[model samples]
Target chain A: MAPLIEVADLRTHFFTDEGVVKAVDGVAFTIPAGKTVCVVGESGSGKSITGRSILNMVPYPGRVLDGAIRWQPDGAPPVDLLALDPKGREIRAIRGKDIALISQEPMAALSPVHTIGNQMIETIRLHLGLTKADARARAAEMLAKVGIPRPKDRLDSYAFELSGGMRQRVCIALAVACGPKLLIADEPTTALDVTTQANILDLFRELRDALGVSILFITHDLGVVAEIADEVVVMYLGQVVEQGRVDDIFHRPLHPYTRALLGSVPRLTRHRPERLPTISGMVPSPFERPSGCLFHPRCDRFEQGLCDRSAPELDRYANDRVARCFKAGAGS
Target chain B: MLTYILRRILFMVPVTLAISLVAFIIIQLPPGDFITALTAQMAENNETLDPETLAALRDRYGFDQPMIVQYWKWITGIVFRGDFGQSFEWSRPVADLIWDRLGLTLIVSFATLVFVWVLAFPIGIYSAVRQYSWGDYIATFFGFIGLAVPNFLLALVLMYLSSRYLGASVGGLFSAEYVNADWSWGRVVDLLNHLWVPVIVLGTGGTAALIRIMRANLLDELKKPYVELARARGLSETRLLLKYPVRVALNPFISTLGWILPTLVSGAVVTAIVLSLPTSGPLLLNALFAQDMYLAGGFILLLSILTLIGTLVSDLLLAWLDPRIRYE
Candidate 1:
């Protein structure tokens, strides 16, 4: 079957006064139906921007300069999201109905002044074309589905009235309320506590199984990727470096950057290192991006001449895996 | 909320009392009482009053009483019988003089308030949403000009332009013929015709300031995460803006209501003088200048009460609009 959504050569750039910032530079990934694809990267790696670009909600001064986001719903014809007007009705109809987004900061995601029910009902009524009473009923049902107790009373409560964990649950309930086919959760659990994070991840897995929804979960936590993701796409400096089954990427990371990322994860061994192993250099500033490989400056196994002289294409490998490196398939 | 409102209202009692005391003291701070001011004017006109008649005048007006006694009598009269004492300049009751102008004063003040709101709200929203656009630039330019130019100067310039180019008689809420006429449709129409001058002149500065405030406030709100989240919910641009950011941005507008009541009675005093409008502002100014303590003090006390009431109304409105605000 065709993938639920396919992103190819996506290049989202910001036109600032100083220079152009290629935030999501030539990135590609696919989210299959009823599966979770975790896009893992550090801050500014453009994972969030890539997610936003799929919804055509990139903020001002930024544009998807070159890309094709082909969205194929279960029974609907395929449509390239980029071809539609950003503010047009067609894209708007798709945004909350077919695809939904949840952000990291739940406190900021929900409006402080509006009741949770009011916001939920608004989205429900808009997308579902239900009357006020029906939408409200649906909203309460959604709150209950997301494990919020006393869902009827909680609907009237303001965002500030809820705890951080409850607020994120509210966000999740809001995103899945419309029965969207694809949900782009941008670091949804990053701001949560460990226990709450586990609960939320469990909720995500339950929702995916129950609703048969595809998830593009963006995060920097490798453990979270392991817990939730079926497939892993590792990104560095706005480009996807390696992508395969989560186990494959974890056990046999093809790209040097991916190997370094996996190496940095703390282990449960008896011996403890004084300092956790870390990738050497900083992610280069967009304006001062080095020629050839963007990750060469930070890669420990950096080839002095070749890695600096020419960029490596994302090369395909056996067992349905891909890595962007000159030494792909070579021993780590 | 009811308890909160009751508490606020109860709190206003002491506040009103303190304000009345301050107003009386400030009115009295200018050297001499009404009798002395009358004597000074008489001396200026080269007409000397006999000592016996002067003593008799002082006795009749109770000017010979101690300061505390006078204040007590004034407060008791106002509280019990709604009397604001006697205006020394007009030789009439202060209540009578103020009541005559209060109607027109309220009319002009309310009209100016409406005018400022009607002009500022949409323009402010536009300027913020379309920041740096040509429309925003034009509004910002006009807003700055309105802020920089004094109301009296603007009034004078508009008066000149209207009389010179529009060929209309300038100033006052009524034409000469209707100045002393009884209430009639013709008089009401005449009042309406002359109302715009003061309304625009008074509203310009307020409108300008409110526009800037609204723009800045909305700009900040538009950048907030909820606004983007609302957009992601598939709401159209206009609906998303009005429902989220604009609702949040209206706090300042509602808070401005607290000052509107006092401004209704005393705002644009200089402009009222320049235009020769028979509003309470000019009446208060003249009373102050001539040392008509009763008249000036009455105006101040009325304004203070109005301010307290206005503040209460604004607080209630703000609580109603924003769910997060709890009146404790």
Candidate 2:
């Protein structure tokens, strides 16, 4: 299948008073049409920034310094999203109508002063050019699609009036309301409880199937990746260290950082260890990034001179897989 | 909502009574009553009041009675007959004096409120949205200057500049010719010409303070996740800003209504005196100085009632604006 969006060598940087911080440096990924691509990383790994850069919604002081986000919606001629003006009408027409976002903070994602119905109706009307009555009907239909009970009444509810779970559902409903081809969910289920998180993941799967929309899901939860991702992109320190089929990435992970991440997940074996394995050392502060391979300082398999002397390019492998490690496919 | 408002209104009765009692006591706290103040004035003029006339005046005004008995008479007369007692200085009913000035006072106050709001809202939004731009810096500088300079001093400066440069007669709500003239189109036009000076003078401090408040509030709201979410909805930047952050920023403007009413009546006292405007502020000041308890107490009670009403109106408006407040 053709990829819905192809992000190549995307470099987003934040210019701060202290110095310049390359937030998402040389990151590359692709989301296939009608497929879920989960971007997994620890905090500060630039997963969220990569997601935001796709929509040209990076916050102030941050710019997409060099990148090409080729969006080929419905097999139309490819449009380079990064090439368009960030504030121009072309990019705006693509946003929400062709690509929408679901934010992590459900509690703070919706305006407290506006009703759910008011917010939903406005978005529907803005992009779809529907009348108020038609927008209301569409909003109500979208709310019901996300399994919100009493969808008509729920439309009148405020963000603060709903539970955390219900709010996430509303956000999901909002994201998919315009029937965008690609949905970028930035840690959409991170703030929820375990059950609600599971329910939201299930909702994402159901909506992806029902609407035939692709999803770029950013998360730190391996379990969510396993449950929902068709492909997985593992990031470390603003770079995509490894990405492949979820089954291959989980069963036979290539990059040392990917192995370390997989090892850190707790298991339910008969002989339980005293403690779960952990990746040693902290994710270095953005300002003082280590030389050579970004993860070399903490890699247990770090070569004495080679790993510290020069950064390794992403090594392509069979089955459309890629890993940025010197010893990617060598025996562990 | 109706029940809530009614409950709040019912709750104001005791509040007003307590305020009236405190105001009446504070008015009486001075060394002597109105009769004593009159006697002192007479003595200053080298005139004397005989004991017989003095006793008769004191008896007639109920000054000879106990303080509690005097308070009872005052409260009963106000509640039962809507009379606010006689002003010792003006020899007129206290209600009449307040009513005569109340109209102009309200007009000035409401005009100033409108002026402050109209100026503050856009300037505040611009400063917040542009943030560190040169426009923001310029606005911040002017805001600080407005807040720092005293209103009366501003009034005086403007008065001086107008009289000197424009050769305009620069005091009162009308020109000298129209001071006691009947209402006419020309007089009304003249009043409008003079009204803006006092409105701007009184509104400066309020406008400056509200601008800072609005900017800070909008800046905070602009950072909320909801604002980003709104922008992601493909909403235009201007629409997203006004719909989300600006709506939330208006809370301070609404909540300020509680104090804005009382300030309307008495806030610009020095400024009014400096400009020679016929507002209630100076009248209330003189009433207190003359130890005219009824008139002074009446003004204080009116202020308290206005404050309560203002609070009620703001609360209702807030409830209308925010669902959380309404349900809560």
Candidate 3:
């Protein structure tokens, strides 16, 4: 099936006093229908920005300068989100009904003063055009579906009153209340405890299985990526360095940055290295991204002359994978 | 919740007593009692204070007793009999004096409070939502100007301009004909007509400060993840703003009610004198200057009661509005 959403050559830049920071510079990916695509990147890799760009909310002082976000609804012509005005009515219709988001911080993702029921019902009423009673019923139903106990009572509880896990569950419930086509879960489990994280992940898979919603999962945790992702896209310094199926990316990471990321993960069933390997050098500040290949400065397989002089295109690897490097999938 | 309120009320008794005691001590801090002030006035007018008359007056007012005994008598009289004592200057009951002027003072304070919130709310929200826009800049500029101008100076300027250009007497609460007139629709209108001058003068600083505060608080709230989540939920910018960030922002503003009442009343003193308005502010000032102990103490005690009640009301309101505070 065609991808539910296809992002092409997207560039989101933040204009600040220091300089222009190309937060998501020419990065692209897609969320296939009914599948979870995890975009893994460390801090400042533009993973969150990529998720936000799909909703056309890059925030103030930042603009999506060039890109095409073609959202393909079932049996309908693909809508180019980049073409729609960010503040206009058409985008508003697409935002909650078609594409909803579950943010990372559960505590900060819900209004402290408003009850969970009010927030959920208002969104439902606005988009689904349901009456207040119907919206409340739907919200309670969604809450129960997300595994919240005493759904009716939970509705009246404020965000701060709920535990971190419970709050994330409510957030999930609210996001999928309207049966959105795509859910952008930006590190939805990062702030949660390990047990709660597993439970939330299971809930996401169930939601996908039941509702057939496509999910664009953004995170830096390789463990989470391994657990949930059908496909994986590795990002570095605001650019996509590798893209492929999760098994392929994990077992056969081609880009130097991707390989380094995989190497940094702790493993069992083997002798442990005395010092855990990490990707050398910090993420370059957005205002001062390196020329040529952005990751060459920290690449373990850095070529003295070639890797430093010109940027390599994302060329094909075996089994329909892509990587940006002079020597793709050679060493291991 | 009932227990919490009951506990708070119980806690307020000692606090109020302490405040009243301090008010009494401060009233007594000046050189001598009302008798001294009376004698000085008589001396200034070159009239001798006859020794027999002085002794008789001292005995009658219990000035011949020890300071502690006099304080005990005063406290007992107020607590048991609800007597705020006699205003030596006006030779009337202090309660009657405060009661007569309390209505006008409350009207002015209440009007100023409403004016502050009404003007600040929308402007503050606009400044925050459209921060760095021209509207924000203009609102900020005017806010700073309002903060910088003294309330008394503003009162004088407004008084002069209105009297000069409009040929209207905007000084007192009522017109010359309605000054001592009985209640009537015409008198009420005249009172309202002159009410705006003091209200505007007193409200300008608070309105400006509140706008800045509201803008800052909402700006902080607007950056929270909930706001973005709301936006992503496709909540229209207006509804999303009002429902989430503005609601959170209002907490700090509401909590200021306690401080606001006292600040407005105290700040009104100079402006009241400047505009020649017949409010409690001018009466309190004169009482303090003349060492009219009962009148001064009465005014202070009333203000203290208002302060305590304002705090309780704000706390209750905050609990009602915010669930986190309510449960806590």
Candidate 4:
């Protein structure tokens, strides 16, 4: 079957004072139905940009260069999300109902003036056409579903009265109340502690299994990917360097960039006591990208003329996994 | 909510009292021999003004005593019996003076507010949303001009043009033909006819101020993440702007109620002069110049009370609109 949501050849760039920052340059990926796909990258690697672009919410001064994000709902023709007029009610209906988004900062995401229950019920009422009474009861149920204690009483409490975790859960519940087929979580646990992050990840897994919702998870933490992701995509400088099932990605990484990233993670088992295999150089600025592969500046597996002058395409590795590197054919 | 509101009202008493006390101090400053001016005028009508007689006038005006004693008397009378004593300039009881002019100013102010919000909000929102478009540029051009040009000049032009256009004489609250005519519907319409020019001119700067404030606030709110989240949640752009952002943006403007209310007095200065309305601002100006201390002080106290009440009302509104703000 075709992917549930497929973004092919997406390019997003920003025109700024200093130079054009090609924030998301020619990235391609697909999210399948009922699967949790985690995108792992550092701060500026354009992982979050991919998530935002799905909703057509790239902020001003940053324009999507070109792409067709096609969506094939259960029995329908694949609709081009990028081509839809932003103001049409059809797009609005599809947004929170079919695709829900939980943003990065939960504190900043929720309106402080509105009580948790007010915002939640407002959304339920808008999407479901529930009566105020029905919406309230439904909101309370959703709140409890997100593990908020005393859901009925909590409805009267403002955003400030709730803790950070509770507020984040409230955000999640609001996003999921309509049973969106696709839930895009952009680093949902960044502000949370380790234990809370684990619990939250577990909650996401439960959400995917029980409700049959597909998740597009974006984060910088490889640890989170290890716990929850069924498939993983590693990105650098706005390009996906490697992608595969979760097992192949962690156990049999082939790309040098991916290898450096996995090696940098702290391991409990005693490995050869060597300095952490840090990537030697920074990702090149978009304006000054190397002639060849985007990762050539920091690729330790680089060979003299081949790595510097020629770009590489994705090559099949051990499983159906793929790595975008010149020497993927050579076993490490 | 009832308890919270009751507690707020109870707390407001001291706040209002404190403001009134400050008002009292401001009014009492630098206007020496308040009673002498009136008593001297009386002396011109062949009344012999001896020292004892002068002291009696002073006592009657409540100026022969210490500040504490005068304050105590005014506060006691105000709290217990709702009396504001008398105006030395107009020879009218202060309460009666307040009663007569208060409605006109309040109506003018309320009308001005409605006028501004009705015009400025849409204009401001349109400007921000279509930023740098001709509508934005045009709105901005007018906003700047509104800030630069003096209110009095606008008042003058309005008076001149209004009379010329409508074949109406541009003087006081009513046309000369109806000045002493019975208070009929016809006369009321005539009153509004003359009143419109001053109201428009007086409210011009305030409306402009509201426009600029709303524009800046909306711009700021539009950039906020919550607004972004609302849009992402499939809220229509209009709903996001009005429901989420405007409420957040109005906090700073609404919080300082005293300043905004007292702006009416400033507007009233131009309004009374332009329309020849018999409002307290013009009366206060005349009394101050005539050194009619009792009359000036009475108006000052009234203006100050309005300022204080404006602040109190804003505080109450802030609490109501934003559950986040608390007085206690």
2 against 3, candidate with superior lDDT: 2
Candidate 4 per-residue lDDT, tens place, A1-332, comes to 66789888888888887888888888888888888989998888999888878888787778888987888877479988878866678777878878989988888888878888888888888889999999999989988888888999999888888777877888899899887999999999998888878888888988898889999999999999999998998898888888899998888887888888998887777476766666788866668878788888787788889888888987777666777898864675
Error of 4 at B323 (Å): 2.1
DockQ of 4: 0.57
Residue-level lDDT tens digits of model 4 in B54-84: 7777777767679878888887887798877
Candidate 3 residue pairs in clash (backbone atoms < 3 Å): none
| Candidate 3: CAPRI quality band | high
Highest lDDT model number: 2
Query: Global lDDT of each model?
Result: 0.90, 0.92, 0.90, 0.79
lDDT, candidate 2, A17-80, per-residue tens = 9988888999998999999999999999999999989999899889999989999987888899
Per-model chain B TM-scores are 0.97, 0.96, 0.96, 0.83
True contacts kept of each: 0.65, 0.71, 0.82, 0.56
lDDT of 2 by residue, B98-150 (tens): 97677788788888889999999999999999999999999999999999999
Winner of 2 and 4 under lDDT: 2
Task: Give the candidates in order of DockQ, highest first.
Answer: 3, 2, 1, 4
Q: How well does candidate 2 score on lDDT at residue B3?
A: 92
Q: List the residue pairs that clash in candidate 4.
A: none
TM-score of chain A, model number 3? 0.97
